[model samples]
Target chain A: MADMIQIEHLKKCFGDLCAVNDLSFRVKEGELFAFLGVNGAGKSTTINIICGQLKKDGGNVKICETDLDKEPDLIKRSLGVVFQGSVLDKDLTVKDNLESRAALYGIHGTKFKERLSELARLLDFEDLLRRPVGKLSGGQKRRIDIARALLHKPKILILDEPTTGLDPQTRTLLWGVVEKLRKQENLTVFLTTHYMEEAADADFVIILDHGKIAAEGTPLTLKNTYTGDFITLYGVSEDDIKKLGKPYERIRDAFRVSVPDTHAATELIIKNPDMFRDYEITKGKMDDVFLAVTGKSIGITGGEQ
Target chain B: MNELFALTKRNTKLYFKDKGMFFSSLITPVILLVLYSTFLKKVYDDSFRSALLAAGADISDSVLNGCVGGQLVSSLLAVSCVTVAFCSNLLMIKDKTSGAIHDLTITPVRFGVLGFSYYLSTLFSTLIVSFCAALVSLLYLAVVGWYLTAADVALLILDVFLLTMFGTALSSCINFFLTTDGQASAVGTIVSAGYGFICGAYMPISNFGNGLKNVLSFLPGTYGTSLLRNHFLRGTFAEMKNQGFPNEVVEAIRESVDCNLEFFGTKVEIGAMYLIICASILLLIGIYITMNIIAGKKRK
Candidate 1:
């Protein structure tokens, strides 16, 4: 696929502190791209620069084959951004909030009505249209915010920690909307999230630490490079576990052994059938990949600990 | 242009929908008018009637009282226009804090267009409130047998429009410096409290000492009050002119009630006053636009 967004040597600083430094990345068309990082890792800074909300100190950014610095308004028109903050006015009703944003985009009259109704149907908030935004639940508000951003039918959607405060069920439903939009419109999604599971499903994932790219690859590839396979055995005694010269955990009568690959993990469990009454093998997780790359857990800094 | 209009419409809808905002822009002014008519009317009538009688112009009680009421009503018009327009700047601050300004900036709407739309919205809302206040005063004037011709009403509208434009522009320029809640509240309180005094709405400018009056000459409300008073009391002043009163006495009463603003010991002619109001609005817009552009360049 063609690249939808391209950044070259992007750098931003605030006084003595560098917010984004010597970073570069490309988001392909119709790709579900994930930007993963701890707090202050420059995900939002980079997003702001691309969205034309903040000026960059140094960099060249091209969105949809147009230079961002030269034609920022043109580029902004093609990009829809839903930042963590709820930009919708709480005092205005759901429909009024959307209508206000629509007016800014120059979508009014029958066209605004049409687009609003379509979004209402898609987000399943038709009944909540007349209700004030402040009265809505967090999940409902998030959905409305997304609907507001997408009203202009932007080709690339930027979501910054969109599902942070959402419930698990709402998160699933929101992602379902994203998936449907992607398949139907071939939308390019650039998402920043702390949820490793959410990043795990992206077509491309990039991890940032201290304003630089620490890891960049597909979820499966990163997992393979950074994570280890594991085997768990039930009804295994300490003496029987000690027979193996590998690290093992004793939980009641069960033992878990870590290995390099699935073959090695399964081979160990098969070789110890008499020691294990029952056994299971499992693959590594995405957070393991994140830990390997950033050397810190999500949202936890070295100084914080 | 269409985008600006749409944004203006949106703000209008929001302003009208909010009951609290309606009261601030409309009801408060009407209530002030009622208080002015009932409580302040007698005091002003007694003082001004005695002053006119002392000026050697034998005037009927009702006509002399009309002059006082007209002056007070016009001064109220100017002060309320400025106060309500300042209140309208709250919408811009709300947009900023709510992050909707960022939301709009990310679209094709430039800051100039957005700012212009906000000003237009403020202008429209101020006019609505000012109109209500004018109606209350005009209705009272009618009860006292002091009626306005249609041309006089037209002149009154023109005066209100210019006053509102000046008020909106001045408020927009000053509000650029307000960011925090403390700053906004402080500015709001100061404008609400000081505008009336400075504009001679609470007390006639003739009562001010030379030093204080000289300082007030720079405030827009002073000129705005003078302009509005001239239009609103045009008929009453004309009647004074036709009653065979000497030109000196008519001018004296006009000066006493702030129907004419003074500059360097000279009365500002109506044409010059209009020019000053228009010129001030233009200068403020120039400053506001240039300020935004510099701020934009700094960001870029």
Candidate 2:
């Protein structure tokens, strides 16, 4: 697949502090790309530069084969960005907000109405057209935000932490809509999220720490490379695990032993069948992989950990 | 061009839909009218009465009351038009704080168009509210005995239009740096309270000391105030002339009521006042456009 977004040595600074330092990444067309980082990890800064909202101190950015510096307007047309905060006018109804934004992209008359209606149905917000954005719930507002981003039929959708404050159920539903759109529209999605589980679903993930990429790969590959499979034993004594342990962590009333893979875990279990009467082997989680690479636990969500 | 109109429409709609902002902008002129009628009416009436009495001109109380009403209305509009502009233009700061500007800028819309939309929006909203204030002033004039000709009314509208342009440009330039609600309101409060006194809107510059008047003379807003004062009180001046009052006495009343302002000891005629106001409007608009262009260049 062709690359939809290509950034080389992207650098941005604020006074003396470096926000995005010599960062480089590529997002291919029709791929779900996740840029994961903790708070203030330069995720929004990078997205702003890509969307032409902020100036880059140094970089070469090409969007859809068009140089960003030379033709930012063309690049902007292909990008639909949902920023971290809600940008809809609080006093205006959802339809009005969407229509106004669509008008900015030169979508009007029958085309605007058709696009809005289609997005309203696709995002399951048909009933919310008349409701003012300020009165909507957080999840409802987020759906409208997504619908607004896709109003112009943008080829690439950039969502900057769209699910940060949403409930788990809402987050799942939001993702369902996004996944459906990606499939139906063949969208190249550039997502920045703090949720490891969300990042785990991406076709490619790049973990950023302190304005630099700590690791980048498919979720499973990242897990296999940075973390190890584990065997959890219930009702196992610490001393008994210590005798056979390569390395182990105590979890409340249970103990988890690290191994190279499921096979190694199975072999360890077989070798010590008497000692491992209540143990089960499990694959490593993406959270563990993120922890291994960034040396900080983003866990399931920023709120959770 | 469509993008500019659409954005401008959105901004104007947002301002009107904001009940607090819309009502606040309208209520300011009414509040000032009430205060002026209550407190400043007697002072202005006494000043006019004393002038006529000193010249032995037997002007009736109705004509004197009409003159006083015109002065109050003109003074109030001079400040209200600009101050309400500072209030109406808060939409720009609100958009900044709410991250709407970021959302808009990321679209295919050109940044220059986006900035121009803001300027146009402020102009439209300010004009609407200022016209409403003018209508209210007209109603008040009816009560006090209308002395204005049809031409005076037309000129009043033109003066209000020019002042609105000045207010929009001046507020847009100043409010560009405002980023938060607190900062915007603070600046709004300061401008609303202090601008009237500085521009000789609340009181005639004739009452002020020479030093302060000289300083006020250099400010463009002083000429804007004088323009409104001229249109508003010209009928009253013509009434004095028709009643057989001598030109010297009429000129004294004109000077007392600030119909003619002096810029550094040079009297500014009505034509010169319009020129100064227009020049100031252009200067302010130029500054605002330059600011937007420089900001755009910085991003590049």
Candidate 3:
């Protein structure tokens, strides 16, 4: 895949504090790329710089092979960014807001109408086009925001914490729509989200810590590299597990033993079939991988599926 | 250019759509008119009568009414055009507070086009409301006594247009420093209340002490009010001349109503006043554009 977004030594600073420090990454075309970080970890700053909303101190950024410094307006045409905060005018209806935003992109007449209708249908916000943006619920507004972002038919969609405060059902529905759009449009989705499970579905993930790339890999690869799989025995005593010469911890009523991988877990279970009759094996979660890499808990447990 | 017009149209629509903003811009002038009629009318009448008595000439009530009405209309317009601008230009601050500007800046639209769209919208909205106020003033003038010629009415419109341009440019410059709704409102309130006094709209500049008059002379808005006063009261001045009143008395009426504002000890000519207002508008617009450019460079 061609590199849709290329960042080399991207740096941004505010006074004495460095917001994005020597950050470098690339997102491939038609890839679901996740950028994960805790608060003040430079996620928003990086996204803003890429969207040409902020100036970087030093960097070479290319979007779809267009130099950011030389042709920022040209680069902007390829990017559809959904900011963390609401940008719609409260007094304007959803249709007016979208139409005005579309005008900024030079989308007009039948092209605007067709694009708006397509996004409305795709994002399940067709009914909300005439309602005032301020009157809509959060989920409804989120759908409208997504529709506005897609109105220009941009190739790269940058979602900055797009589902931060949404309900579970709404988040699931939003992700489903995003997945569908990704498939249909061949979109290179650059996402920053707090939900580990959302990042888990990405083709590649980058974990940022204190303005640095702490870790980067596929979801499964990061999990296997940073975290260990677990095997829980319902009736095994701690001493019996100690006798097995494996590290073990006591759960509510089970002995949980950790292993390097699913292969090790299955091997141990098969070797002690009598002791592991009532046992369940689980793979490491993205949450665990995140915790291991950043050494800080995200506090929302995404259990194994 | 099409994008610019689209955004400008949307912005103008947004201004009128907000009930508080739209009504406030219109009501401010009406309120000023009412206050002037209720309290200031007698002050102006008494001053005119005394001027006539001292001159040993008795002007007819019809011509006296025309003169007083001209002062009323000129002061109302001079103040309202500016205050209405402060209200209409709130759309810029609204965009900033709502983060709508963020969405706009990220688009492919150039900053120059975006900025010009905002300026055009402010100019159009302010002009619409100010013209409506001008109509009301004209109606009031018709009711009191119609002394203005077709040329006078035409010149009054030209004055309104020039004042609106100055007000829009001044408001845009001030609003560049404002970001929040509270700040914008506070500034709006201050301008709406304090501007009339500063421009000598609420009272004659001749009534103010010489020290203050000298200070007011430096502001272009002072000249703006003088320009409007010249057009609005020219018909009455000519009437006084026809009624066999002396030039010094006509000049006294001019001085009393701020038609002949003195810069330092030298009296400013009517043509020079227009030049000053035009220059101030250009200066204000230049300042606003420079601020945007500096801010844009900082962002880059």
Candidate 4:
């Protein structure tokens, strides 16, 4: 796949504090990529610099192989951004906000109508266009924001913490919409999220810590490398498990043993058949990989599923 | 560009749709008009007529008092328009609060579109308020037999438009300097209270002299007040003349009330005043743009 976005030697500082430090990364085309970080990890700063909302101190940024410094307006034209906060004019009706945003992008007439229709179908917000954005639910407002960004049919979409404050059902629904867009339109989505489970759905994940990339890989690979699978045996005696010499921790009524892979899980289950009545194998979670790489736990942990 | 127009349209819609703001802009001007009609007009007219009578001019009480009262009341209306226009600039704090401005800055739209659209919307709101005030004053003048010719009426409208544009430009500059909605509101109050007194909108500039009058002459808003008074009161001057009042005495009153602005000890031509006003508006706009560029470079 072609590199849709490339950044090298990026640096940003605010007074004495460095916000982003010599960051380097590439976002491949037609892929859902997730950027993970704790607070103040420079995720939004990098995004802002790329979008030309803020000037960078030192860096080379390219969008689809076009140097961002040479063709900033061109890069902006090819990208759609749903910023961290609500960008919609809450006092204006959803339709009015969309129409105005479309006009700013020079999208009009038949093309605008067609795009609005398609977005209405895709986002399931056809009936709520006339309502004021301030009166809408959080999920509904987010949908309008996404629909507004998609009006220009951008080649790349950047959603910065798009589902940060939404309900679980709404987050799932939004992810579903994004998945559909990824499959149907081959949209290159670059998103920042604290939800490790949400990052698991991405084609690639990069965890940032202290203005630098801490880890980067496919989600499954990162999970397998950083996190261990757990084999929990119910109704097992701690002394009976001592013979195997595998490290064990008694969790509630079960004796839990951590293993490197599923092969170890199968071997342990067969050997411990008499030692335990029932056994369960649990896959590793993404946060374990995040915690292992960053060494700092994130505070945003409500409804992360 | 189409983007500029679109943003202007959106801002205008958001402003007028705000019921609290729309009605709030009207309240002070309407109350001022009511006070002028019922209570203040007679006192001003009687005082001016008695002074004229004491001078042995023997001018008709109706004509002389009408001239004085009409000029004062309409000047109030024009100044009130500017005050409301100043209030309207507070609408921008919403954009910053909602983070809509951040969304706008990232787009492919030209920088001029983002800034000028705001100025244009402010211009629209100021014009609407001032124009309505002018119409009400015109209607009152006509009822009192101080009718203006069609050309004079057109000139009056032009003055209102220009005054409001000046107000819009000044208010836009002020709005850009403020970061919080509370600051904008405080600015609105400060302008409402302080600007009128200095610009000769609340009182005749002739009441002050020496350095104070000279200082007032340099303010851009002082030009707007002078423009509005000259346009709205020209008919009153003609009415007093037609009533067979002595030319010199009526001229003296016009000069005292500042029917024209003086620059560096010379009477400024109406055309020159317009040019100065236009230049000032453009200069302020240039400053606003420059500030935005500087801030966008240095800060978020």
lDDT tens digits by residue: candidate 2, B137-245:
9888888868889999999999999999998989999998899999999998999999998988987899999999998898888888888888888888888789888
Q: Which runs in model 2 stand beyond 4 Å of their true positions?
A: A232-243, A248-255, A269-280, A299-305, B209-211
Model 3: per-residue Cα lDDT over B39-70, one tens digit each: 88898889889878987989888888888988
Q: What stretches of model 1 exceed 4 Å from their correct place?
A: A250-253, A260-273, A299-305, B27-31, B56-58, B145-147, B209-215, B241-244, B293-300
Estimate, for each residue in B1-300, the C-alpha lDDT of model 4 and write its tens digit. 889888999999999888777887877678778877787777777777777878677665456645765676556766786788787776667788778887787778766567788888878887788778888887777666464668777877887777777777788878887778788778888888887788887677877876787888788777777776776677777877777868887787778777767776788788887888788878988877776666654532
* Predicted structure 4, TM vs. truth: 0.93
Of all native A–B interface contacts, model 1 reproduces a fraction of: 0.65
Error (Å) of candidate 3 at residue A248 is 5.2
How far off is each candidate at the interface, as Cα RMSD in Å? Answer: 2.0, 0.9, 1.1, 2.3
Order the candidates by TM-score, highest first — what do you get?
Answer: 2, 3, 4, 1
Two-chain complex of model 1, DockQ on C-alpha atoms against the true structure: 0.54
What's the TM-score of chain A alone for every prediction?
Answer: 0.93, 0.92, 0.93, 0.92
Ranking by DockQ: 2, 3, 4, 1
Q: Looking at model 4 chain A, which ten-residue stretch has the lowest summed lDDT?
A: A296-305
Output the better candidate (3/4) by lDDT: 3
What would the per-residue lDDT of candidate 3 be over residues A137-186, giving only the tens digit for each residue?
Answer: 99888888888888888999999889978888888888898888888889
lDDT, residue A144, candidate 4: 90
- DockQ per model, Cα: 0.54, 0.76, 0.74, 0.60
Q: Residue by residue across A208-230, what tens digits does model 1's lDDT show?
A: 98889999999988887888887
Which 10-residue span in candidate 2 chain B carries the lowest summed lDDT? B291-300
Candidate 2 collision pairs: none
